[model samples]
Target chain A: MTKKQIQEKIAFTVLTMTMFMVVIPTLLIIGYIIYKGIGTISWEFITAMPRKGMREGGILPAIVGTIYLVMGTIILALPLGVGSAIYLTEYAKQGKVTRLIRLAIMNLAGVPSVVYGLFGLGLFVYFLNIGTSILAGALTLACLILPVVITASEEALKSVPQSYREASLALGATKLQTIQKVVLPFAMPGILTGAILGIGRAAGETAPILLTVAAFFLPRLPKSIFDQAMALPYHLYIISTQVPNMPQGIQYGTALTLLGLVSIFFMLATVIRIKFKMANRA
Target chain B: MSKISVKDLNLFYGDFQALKNITLNIEEKKVTALIGPSGCGKSTFLRSLNRMNDLIDGVKIKGDLKLEEQDIYQKDVDVVALRRRVGMVFQKPNPFPKSIYENVAYGPRRYGIKTRKQLDEIVEKSLKKAALWEEVKDRLSKSALGLSGGQQQRLCIARALAMEPEVLLMDEPTSALDPIATAKIEELIVELKKEYTIVIVTHSMQQAARISDETAFFLMGEVVEVDTTQKIFTKPRDKRTEDYVTGRFG
Candidate 1:
């Protein structure tokens, strides 16, 4: 065979191997979780309180708490993050101040989740005196996801052509007007995807919530924002490690449940992205 | 009456002067064509009309430019309001990623025309003036990006017309489109001049000759000639202008 044919064979072989390595493991993990978790999924399991052993008891409070936390984080983070991104991309001049601000945000995303947890505990719980409440933890997670949301949204907004801004400006639209009417609607899908991804990451987080309001394993429902809550990841951690003599089956179930929730969040984000793409194509 | 007048207009980007000291009168409700080689500053001059170049960083200007007999570079002049009277269509068709209806209604809505009836009327009338309403009437809900290149170009024109500006500036709009689209846009220009003062910058000599009522030829940041289209194309003028017009050297 010629040298070109041998090189082509090597390239294809490498590409195939890489694809399989990534795909097989992902499918295997998802398959294992579904196989184990499907059995544990019941109306009672989803709605029942944590009265008995975690295996027999339902995950009702944890499910509700997770949803509440995700909602609060989204409500708290989206506007602030997207607004800052808009200022950086559209309004801010490219100079020392902007560059410094950008660098700080990039570093914020890199800080360990545990550090964010500590910061949240000190700032929200201690200083602000919110004190071991769901609101406190939700606020913390908002900060944790803020940098990701801002950076992703900035990238999305920047992808829109500058000519669109020029067109709006030339047509007598004010800077604020141009952004609101033209630039934003165009960048909405991408910005939403970023927020969704941030929400997913915030939903799956264990360490940050563990040090905050998620440290509790309350047997009853949270009455208000100040009430302590048990999240899915923390429930998984308590079931698998903290609880006494937990069954192997229960640990696997907990793992499967945690994975299921994160996967659902991810799938929802993907569905939203795909819907936008389909509509854009149509 | 002259709608826009420029006097001793000079602009520099950092240190390199993009436009020379130029003075001219643009009459109201007439089609003016600016023709030049690449980087001859015709587009710059065009952009300076509405302070569109103000968005660029480090662009310095020393000149007196008047619109409707008011000095545009006046310190207290509202740039946004000034721009409302002068609408620009770019060299390439850049439609906002929105439905055709929303794209046309954006300008009116921004200026507080919130009544659904009023906005609908504006969209319909503007699209009709652009001669694009029939083509897009059936698919107003579709994304502007879904349209063909020619259709998108016309949609852009309709969008600008919706703003009800006094002057329309087009910077080589047909350069990015096919021959058929170019012809349609050229025809639209002739129809537009009846109500709005229209100025277009183009690289096509034939296009300048065919559609323009008045043509201004630029060379090395200077206006070499400006006169009726017939005179610029047929009669002998300056040596450089005549040679360049004859395709000797662009």
Candidate 2:
């Protein structure tokens, strides 16, 4: 019909095609994994210890290890990330130095996870003598996720209206008090979302933990920070590629378990985001 | 008697001067309104009272600004204490994203009032002072963002009053409200003058005539005239003041 209508139709079609291209692959992968692995997931599979040269029984230690790693990473990253974000957004003068620091953080986020693994190997494993343990792995993952946390937190901090700060300051609150009582609370939900996303990334990471932790055949759970642990991603990697003649059900189950763990983190973040949005509205 | 005094006050934002040679004395328990065209530095002058201007980088102030015989611009002056003594309400309503009670209680809490009973009393008293107590008394624990624009503005006033400041600086407090809301705030301002000295910046000339005890017309960063609202409105001294009053020009 009309030329304008034809052009609009073409543009809409192109956008829909691009959206499908992105959505299809993600759904395909997740759907395939669920189809292949759903039968393998069970209460025993989630809670039982591995046996028969990692070909039988369950992946209880790996699940527990991932939980520990995620917790440690959050403990290390959240405060440091939020603090740096506050300084960058509120205290730092908008000039060359601030710009440079922002650029460095962006670059840090782009660096390969393998490079982080090597750094962890050298620093946490050997130089620091913390050894291949949960502490080392968590610290390494913390480093890997620090940039994401900082950027997200900075964005959250920036999104808070300047009017709130002015109101607090004008009401006789000191700068620190205003930040603590007003600004921080307003930005808390956003900061938490960022932290949860970071935790998810840290939980799913294999390379950083591979060199720093990931005990291959450990039947017992890590009792201390110094003890080596079996993480989900690394366990999946071992079962699927390294372990000779590993059972198909076990490999799919490990993959499914890792996916489930990461999804839980993402779901948690979504729930929190929604709750905060409702609270803000109220 | 003068509660706050200024002598040849000049303010600059980087290279551009915003307020120039502004000399005025604000009396205790009086409603003094600063009226001018947009960007004539009326709002800037209001902000200068509590050193709220200090928050802006590249801002420079010269000459003397004194509150009750104390030079507020002096380096040794405790800005936090000064702000506590002189509170401010902004042009737009800015209630914190908190309960109405928490919004009012925020100031006293900062000064280390932690008990719920004390905070509750202060919140009620401040809200009553701002003429918002009866309307919001039931919803004190509810989020303040749920209130209407005018209510939110009154809530902000209540928040400022919670600090128990002697001087209240309002930067166009009702500019964002409907006519009914504006009238209510005007009534509140008149009632508030019995206790606290008030300085307000408004764009509405009719508003200044209706509420202000004294009026200062700012023109191009200078005080064109400062006198009793009646004299300034009826028998104006300067040609610019006469023209501005008679709706000749801003």
Candidate 3:
């Protein structure tokens, strides 16, 4: 009833509310993902190619397509992404161009996935004439992931101590030699981690693929860069929305399969992190 | 007649001059000590010997830095080769996060020294020169980062020595070390001077008085005086040097 007691009560009430507000939503989202996604899990659901409207429909082609996408995307994105990151972090001075490029990448990450999808559809499919295929989807996905790849890679390279560079140079190594010998190895783990995250983002991407590569259905696996492909998310959307005789288990299976794929990518990331930490400790 | 001649040198880190017009002749195969307060540019001047200031983003230099009468900053000079001839040891021990053997091999490897036996010999010689051989000899494959702080710094010194540079620069090499490590490093410095031209910057007046044949005193970027270590410490030519040596002011 006293003022001091009232203040204490209000402080406690706000603290409790704040904690619950953060904790409850995070727990609920994680719980919901597991609850809705844990069922329909099996190797059969993930490794076999999708068969629309069937309980046994597998995401084999979609899985293969995703892997192909990751490969092509990494090959295309890693060089440019890491190279630009190195240039920015190591060589480039903090000037207008560097500042502008950083600001642009930040804005790009913030842009909606649907917006990225439309741009991919326009740039990769329509303009580049790659057509509706794995390559186009990958090119699009690579573009989608480039900003994150560059930012993380730049941070990683920057994380290397200036003393390392100085020590290398003092050893009579040239500037480029110092970076190649000392800076690059130290930053390698960070770049790998960034790459793994980029791959995950690229793999889990559904909206962009829908517009660029997954717009049309292919009963069979894509035969070439010009051929249409099946993606798990698109397959899930199609089976759940378009197919009349689609089995109930197919949607759950596809969702669970997609969840597993993303988790695999994350596990790979964790493994790489451990490798870097161990290397540093050693 | 000395191995290194620095004449009328001034250094500025973007208009804030760090070293005044300073001149000193460093004898070959002899140890020279540069003693000064923090921010007095002893370290800055030491870096100039190897052109290490080029690493600073916007450092400016105006002076004659000559190694045996050859101008160091001339347009024709290769900074890399110059650095190879003049190795530097930093204040804090900074060893590469690599194997003990690889740390020593880094310079020679960069300069195109290949073959396992050759690198092993250099590593062995350099480690022995640095007084680090007995401890690290058996486990050359171990990471340099695993060494204790003092050991790491000595490994860094060994890494620098592996190149077999003509002139060795030590910028407060023992500042980060405890007394035992400092004593070992100081002793090593004195011993190394028998074959190498050594220039060391130290804050400890007693260190300079004990280890150096010749000493230079700096204050606020100016070379206050240059004389024999005994003279600088006991009977300095400049009042400021006398004040600094007597702990009147930094």
lDDT of 1 by residue, B1-250 (tens): 8889888899999899998887878888888899989999999999999899999989998989999778999899998888878888899898877789988998888878999899989999999999999998999888898888888888888988998999999999899999999999999999999999999999999998888888889888888888888898888488888998999998
lDDT by residue for model 2 over B1-105, one digit each (tens)? 999999999999999999999999999999999998899999999999999999898999999999999999999999999999999999999999888999999
Best candidate per DockQ, number?
A: 2
Tens digits of per-residue lDDT for model 3 on B19-118? Answer: 8898889999988999988988888899999998887778988989899979998989999999999999998888888889999999999999999999
Distance (Å) between predicted and true CA of B26, model 2?
0.7
Rate residue B174 of model 2 by lDDT: 92
Count clashing residue pairs per candidate: 0, 0, 1
Name the runs in model 2 displaced over 4 angstroms.
none
Please give the ranking of all candidate structures by DockQ, highest first, separated by commas.
2, 3, 1
Tell me which residue pairs clash in candidate 3: A48-A60
Candidate 1 lDDT tens digits, A126-146: 999999878998999999999
Q: Point to the candidate with the largest lDDT.
A: 2
lDDT of each prediction vs. the true structure? 0.86, 0.93, 0.85
List chain A TM-scores, every candidate, in order.
0.93, 0.97, 0.85
What count of clashes does model 3 give?
1
Could you tell me the lDDT of residue B143 within candidate 3? 92
TM-score of every candidate relative to the true structure: 0.95, 0.97, 0.93
In Å, residue B29's CA in model 1 sits off its true spot by 1.7
Interface RMSD for model 2 amounts to 1.2
What is the lDDT ranking, best to worst?
2, 1, 3
Q: What TM-score does candidate 1 get on C-alpha atoms?
A: 0.95
